[model samples]
Target: MKTLKIGLLGLGNVGTGTYEILAMNAAKISALTGCEIVISKVLVSNINKKRSLNLPADLLTENAADILSDPEIDIVVELIGGIHPAFDYMLTALQNKKHVVTANKAVIATLGDELMSAAAASNVLLKYEASVAGGIPILNALSTALAGNEFDEIVGIINGTTNYILTQMTDFGLNYDDVLKDAQAKGFAEADPSSDVEGEDVAYKLSILIQTAFGLKIPPLSIPREGITKVSKDDIAYASQFGYKIKLLATAKKNGSTLECHVQPALIPVSHPLASVSNEFNALFIKGNAVDDLMFYGKGAGSMPTGSAIVGDIIDIARKLDCLPCCLTPQISAPTKLIFAGEGKSMYYINFLVADVPGVLGKVSTIFGDHGISIESVMQRSKGKSEGEDVPVIYILHESSRQQLDPALAEISSYPFIKEVRSILRVEPLN
Candidate 1:
């Protein structure tokens, strides 16, 4: 039987899981593919780091050059979650004419175009099925399964950490800090949870998805990003009162030749499919010209789930080698102009903590009207016992472009009667 040799880069949680699964299912994999897959080398940070699996000592090496330079290694699996050495290592492996697979979103989001070109040049497969949404197979669906159709929009809860925190906040009325602490303790969040909580992580994943779905390759920094760090219990309660749920959503839509991509905490209608994606799970709602609306849901992150995606790519590459003429080639096209926040039209939910005095609401309404933004609905809730202190007023505004509302919001912020403008969330139409 033929044998495919694998070189692993990192032995972190996801990498270890990949090695374990490959070992445990070796016989089954060999039976299906008519080939045996074996780990030929492992490049880790420390050779003395205690590993749970009893890997062959001869296969271990602290130097990445050892794996990249080896002639016997056919595939290089990079599980290192960073830009520096991981990016450099993958580039080297591709240059050496070795098939490459990685789970690093940072590398894929930033350098995917260059990597794809390198793989095509070297005539080797570059698979990153594990980058965006873990175990979801969204990339495969977009690139291969739905390649026949023109996709319109992709909306999803792609980040598990923010979803978990928001889920707890909405369900149990927990605060952000408390739930974030709990998430960290439960291993759902990292030591420094800025990337996940600040929406950078989701933005990175969305960049990859948007590239695959719309053939656009804008960096994460180019996309408008807003986090759940400022989201409060009051905001969640108000959304509930208005028949909506607050979810940190990554959305991309095509308009003519332009693509709009943004990641932020938005007010999704209670009836929307993504509104109910709670905890660490993820769901993607995709709209295509031929397929209409299709949903892909699964565990967004975890060692085993991500590992499964990597292994699936390995198996696919192995199988394709037999009949396919060349390695996987990504469809590269010119990037479409991104719809800036200043140009898009959408409705908004605005909450104001104002003094309980006459004409305060009228003053706020006049400011919005002067800017050509009309109010859809307004709800006033009494601050029970502290009636004379302040009151909460919530307004749902009609569909208006950011060009109009941004100036209006800025002017309203200076009003003395308006003690605070607590929250402003964009609302998407249901149906």
Candidate 2:
């Protein structure tokens, strides 16, 4: 068997896992792929820093040139999490005629098209199976296994940090702040978790998923994104009373020529498969023309799980060396117009805290009626309990367009009697 040399960038959590897996399963991986993966060099910020894995000091270097300029390095695996230096290094690696594999969703979502074009031009492969929902192989499945089918919908919980927080909140009846602090303490979230909590992380993953499933690359910021920060205990409790569980959902659905995509907090039916995917686990719900519906569930992010995905890419690249390719090259489909209008509507749950007055309810109802939104269900606090106090009212709106609801909701929130628009959770109807 021939040897496949790998130059890894970043010796952090993912990098350490990749090295350990390759070193631990060297024999098994060699046997399966008919090739040995050698870690030729690793680029790190510090060469003398203590690492989890014991490695020869000669293999570590602080400079990217040590790895990128090395002609013996067949593939460059980037585990660095950002788009700046990681993007530059990967581009240089591709320019040097090396196959590239990355686990950076930010880079892949934003710069993947450029990298893919470069790879095609150089006839080298660019793989990113670990970029989204780590180790689940959803991207590979979408590009290879489900390539022939045209998918109409793709929804998933792609961020583990946010998922963990939401799961804790739902299970413990904890508020967002309390659950977020717990998540941070548990190392599932960061000290400054604006990226994950604000839904930017899922947007990156969703953008990549849309690219893989639909063959059209899109900017992450283009998606209508709303994070879980607004989610409260009341939202979770209200969802449960209505037979649903609140989750931060990344959704993309095709409507005629347009693809409606967004990242937001949504209420999934309690008995649904996705609702059961809680506590840092990720699940993808896909609707394809041929396959109908497919769900993939697993740990979304972890050292070993993500490293397993990275190594899977390496093994695939190794197996194809000097042999016939079994899997097809990724097709780069032309970008299509992504329109968000006329998409199917869903029942919305809105928590309203209004003044305890006689006509307050009537006024809010008038707003809903003006927008042609009928109330399917209503739950209000008792009338005689407190006068002049803010009364909590929850309404499940009948199916209505999101575009229409947004304006009416804006109008309703402006009333002086409306103390707050507590929450608005979209209820996903079962297919």
Candidate 3:
């Protein structure tokens, strides 16, 4: 049996969880992999700071070379969660012929092409199962298990903070600000939640999934996304009244030659499988030509779940050295094109405040007709403030291309009768 050395970068929450898991279960994991996994060095910002998990102080070092340059370390597990030095560190590790495992979705999504090519040149594994969906192992399933099938669609609730906020808004009828405060207080959100609430986090993850599934490296920016920051209590109430739920949905689907990918708050019928997912939980509803449909569900983010994913990749790397991992498949990257936003079609929900006056609805309908946006349903509710005052108006439309809605909605928003565009979301029709 061999003892594999692992140098961990960024000993934060995930880093601590990885160290604990490896130390506590070393014997069992070693038995499984036929090699003892050792945490030889850990790169941290402050080595003297008190940590949750206790290890020998000597294990901590601030220098990347402590791990990157260590000749004895075979694997470098990076949990730094950002792109700057973490990217350079992982890149250097690969150039040094060391296998790498990371939970940095930002690095993987943005810099995956460079890193993957480096690993290939070095002939070592660059695994990042923890980068997407926390511990769901969706990356592995896409790259290896589902590799045989031609994937048609991947729709997911991959952001835990946004999902938690939306759940609180739906269940408690709270506004975005209130639920965001609750999520932060409960440790589900970061102080700066722009990444999670603004939909950047889900977009990064979706980018990783897209490239992994289609073997393409579409830039994350190209996947047009809208966040849940605009979702309001009235939209939640209106959705519940209509027997539907609101979720921040990340979607990727192939149409002929162009892949359609986007992230936004979507209205899903309550009976749909993804509609039931709530409160910091994540689920990816994958549709493939052979598998038909598959859902992978789990706690999308947490120290241990992410750590478990990191260790799983570490084990796979060890097994590649003849340690007998369950499945050892590498991610392959190629090229493909994606459709621009508004070029695709989907049912949509638009909530706006309009002057409660005669001819206002007619003018809105006239604009819709001008743009060829077919309205599926409409709900008009007075706020009981004043006569001829603004009240909330909700519109659910049939499948219409964004090309049809964009101009019409822009024109409606400019109308003096339309007070404000409260919310706009896509509706994922029930299968």
Candidate 4:
């Protein structure tokens, strides 16, 4: 049997899991690929760091150069979750003609085009099936299985931390802050949860998904991002009443040559497939001209789940070693005219705390009418005044563009009787 020596970078949760899975499942993996995959070397920050995996002493090292310079290592699997050394290490590995498999979405989203070019030139395989949705194989599905169809759009609840927080808020009536603390306590969120909570994590993942699904490459920062940090208990209650569940949705659609991408908290109808995905699990909704709409759901993040994806890539690469092509051909070019977020149109759920008086609704309705924004539905609830103040009112808009709605909001905000606008969330349709 052909033997494939592997070098691993980092020995954290994911790295240790990859090592354990490969070791425990060696016989099955060998049978599947007809190759013995061995972890020949590991690069870690501290060789003295207590690793959960009891790897051979010779295989562990503190120096990354030891692994990268070794010509015997056939494939390098990078599980280091960061931008700095991970980016430099992957680039160097590709330059050295070593095939690479990684689960770092931030690195892939930011430097994927350049890395793909490097791998292509070096005739080495660069696989990142675990970057977007953990264990779902969404990347392979988009690049291979669904390649025959013209994809209309991709809507995903791709970030697990945000999803977990949203699920808590919706299911248990907890606010964003409370759910976030719980997520951190449960190890679902990091100490510095800004990346996950502020939607940067989803934005990074969406960048890769957009590229794989539609051959689009847009900077993560370019996508408009709004996190669930501002989603209050009141918003969750109001959304539930409207037959909607609030989710952090990452969306990408082709607008002529422009591919529109954004990550934000959206109001999805409860019956939609994405709305029902609760907790740390994730679901992706893909709309294609031929396939119509399809959903892929699974664990979004974890040691074993991510390790499974990495192993799958390793097995596939080993099987295809000398038979077909060494590297995948670039399937699609970057779309030239990708649409910006503010240019897209959608229905909105606007909750305004307006005056309870009779003419107050009429004035607000006239302003919306003048702006050509329609109200699909309206709900007004009275919170008994603690200090004898005006009651609050909520309005849900039917459909409108930012161009039309922004002016309307500004006009409404300036009204004398309006106490406060509690929240405004975009409503994503099921069909």
Candidate 5:
């Protein structure tokens, strides 16, 4: 069997896992791919830093050119998690006619099209199976297995940190701050987790999904995203009372000629498959014309899981080494001409505080009616305060667009009887 050499780019958690897996499963991988896969060099910030894996000092390097410019290295696997030097290194690798595999979602979501085109020009492949949901193989499935079908919707809990926090809050009735601190202590969240908690990570993953599933190039920032920071214990309790669970959802739907997408805290029905996916696990629900509905669930962000995905991509490229360059090139279909709309109509959970008065509910309903909003359910709880004091009121509003709902909410909030608009969350209806 021939030998396939790999130049690995980072020695972080994912890089360590990748090296260990390749070493432990060398015989099996070689047997399956008919090639002896080897890590020729590993790039790290510090050559003397201690790692979990023991390796020869010669295999480690502080310089990237040792790998990127090496003619013996057939594949450049990038595990660096950033946009600057990582993107530049990957681009240079592609320019050198080497196949590039990356686990950096930020780079893929932002610069994938350029890299794909470069790979096509250089007669190499650019694979990013680990970019979205780690170890899920959802991207490969979308690009190859389910390629024949047209996807209608793709929704997922793509960020493990936020999902873990939300899961803890919902299951234990803990406050957001408490669960977030616990998650950080458990290493499930970063010290500065704004990217994950603010929904930017999910938005990045969702943008990649849009490209793979719909063949469109939508910028991650363009997708309207609301994070889980606003979700509170009261919101979780209210969701349970209504037979739902609160989750940070990344959603994209094909609606006629428009694509509706957003990342936000949504209330999923308890019966839905995604609701049960809790604590560091991730799940993606895909709706296709031919396959109907498909759900993929697994560990979203562990070192080994992510390493498995990266190695899987490497194996695929190794197996197709002799294939024609044109045939091996990725078919990122032409950008579809779909209009992008921000968070389209859906059932909404609206919670607010209103004065404890008889006519307040009627007046709010009147405002909703005038704005084309309908009430599906209503819950009023007395706080045992004196007369004319504000009390909590929750409403499950029927299908209404934000354009209408915002105006209605603005009008309602201006009234002296209205105390606050506590929360507004989307209710994802079952298909």
Candidate 6:
């Protein structure tokens, strides 16, 4: 069998896991692919830094040119987690006619079109199966298995860090800050977890998903996103009382000639599949015209899970080394006809503090009626309200757009009986 040498970039947790997987599953991988896959060189910042993996002294190098410019390397695997040098290195490798595989979602979401065009120009395949949900082959399924079907909607709990934090808050009644600290301590979150907690990470993944499923390239920043920072124990308790769970959901839907997409903290029914996906696990619910509804669930993030995705992409490219480069023209195309509608109508959960008076709900109802908004349900507990103290009131509003609801909320906020609007979350209809 011929040999396919690999040049690996970065040596972090996922990088180490990739090396170990190749080493442990060498014989099986070779037997399956009919190629002896090997990591010929690794790029690191400090070549002298000791690693837990028993790598050869000759294999480590501080220079990236040794891999990017080499004629012998068949593939360049980029494990670096940023857009700066990783994007440049991948572009250079593709320009050099070397096949490239990466797990960097930021680069892919931001500059995927340019890279795909580069791969097509150079007759090389640019594979990034590990970019979105780690270890879940959702991209492969979308590009190949489900390619025939028209996807109507894609809803997923893609970020494991935020999901873990929200799960802890729902299960144990813990606050967001306390659960976030726990997540960081347990290695589920980064020290500066603004990316994960602020919903930017999910936006990146959603952008990739939009391309794969809808054949549309929407900028990640353009997707309206709301983080889990405002989610509190009180909100979690209220959701339970209403037979729902609060989860940060990445959602995209197709509506005739327009597409709607957003990432926000929403309330899903207790019986929904995404509601049971707790802790660090992930789940995606897809609606296809032919396949009906399909849900993919598994470990979304971890060293080995992400590494498994990387190795899978490497093997895929290795098997096609002798064949012509597969065209990604359809994969990276922008939506020409479909209009990008920001966010569509949905049911809402509105919580606010108000004076425990008889006519407060009536006045609020009048405001909502003036704005053509209807209430689905309302809940108020008498146990927490003292004779003169303010009490919390929850309202589950009927389907209404943000444009219609915002004015009513603004009008209600000016009332003297209103103390504060505690939470405003969307309620997703999963059925």
All candidates: CA RMSD in angstroms? 1.8, 2.1, 2.3, 1.8, 1.3, 1.4
In candidate 6, what are the lDDT values of residues 1-431, reduced to their tens digit? 89999999988988888899999999999998999999999999998887999877799999999999999998999998899899999999999988898899999999988888898888888988888999899999988899888889999999999999999999899999999999889899999999999999999999999988888879999999999999989999999999999999999999898899999999999999999999999899999999999999988877789899999988888777766545422245333477789999999999999989889988998899999999988988668566988898999999999999999999999998999999999999878
Q: In model 5, how large is the Cα lDDT of residue 42? A: 95
Question: Judged by lDDT against the true structure, how good is candidate 3?
Answer: 0.86
Q: Candidate 6 lDDT (Cα, whole model)?
A: 0.91
Better of 3 and 6 by lDDT: 6
Give lDDT per model, in order. Answer: 0.87, 0.87, 0.86, 0.85, 0.91, 0.91
Residue 291, model 5: Cα distance from true site in angstroms:
0.8
**Backbone collision count in every prediction?**
0, 0, 0, 4, 0, 0
Q: lDDT per residue, candidate 3, 275-334, as tens digits? A: 989998999999999999999999888989998999888887887786333233246654
lDDT of 6 at 44: 92
TM-score of each: 0.96, 0.95, 0.95, 0.95, 0.98, 0.97
RMSD of 3: 2.3
What range of 10 consecutive residues in model 5 has the weakest lDDT sum? 326-335
CA error at residue 153 for candidate 2, angstroms: 0.8
What tens digits encode model 5's per-residue C-alpha lDDT throughout 1-431?
89999999998988888898898899989998999999999999998887888788799999999999999999999998899899999999999999999999999999888898899889898999999999899998998899989899999999999989998998888999999988889899999999999999999999999988987778999999999999989989988999999999999999999899999999999999999999999999999999999999999888899999999999999999977776678667636778788789999999998888788888899999999999988888785667767788999999999999999999999998899999999999966
Better of 3 and 4 by TM-score: 4
Report the error of model 5 at residue 94, Å. 0.4
Candidate 3 regions exceeding 4 Å error are 323-330, 334-343
Better by TM-score, candidate 5 or 2? 5
* Tens-digit per-residue lDDT, 1-431, candidate 2: 68899999998988988999998999999999988889999999888888888788699999999999999999999998888899999999988989888999999888888888788777778899999999799988987788888899998988989888888888888989988888888899989999999999999999889877876666898887889999988788878988889889999888788787888898888888999988989999999999999999998888999999999999888777665442324356535566653235778999988887778788889999999999888888755666667888999888888888999999998998889888887888756
Which of the predicted structures, 4 or 6, would earn the higher lDDT when compared with the native? Answer: 6
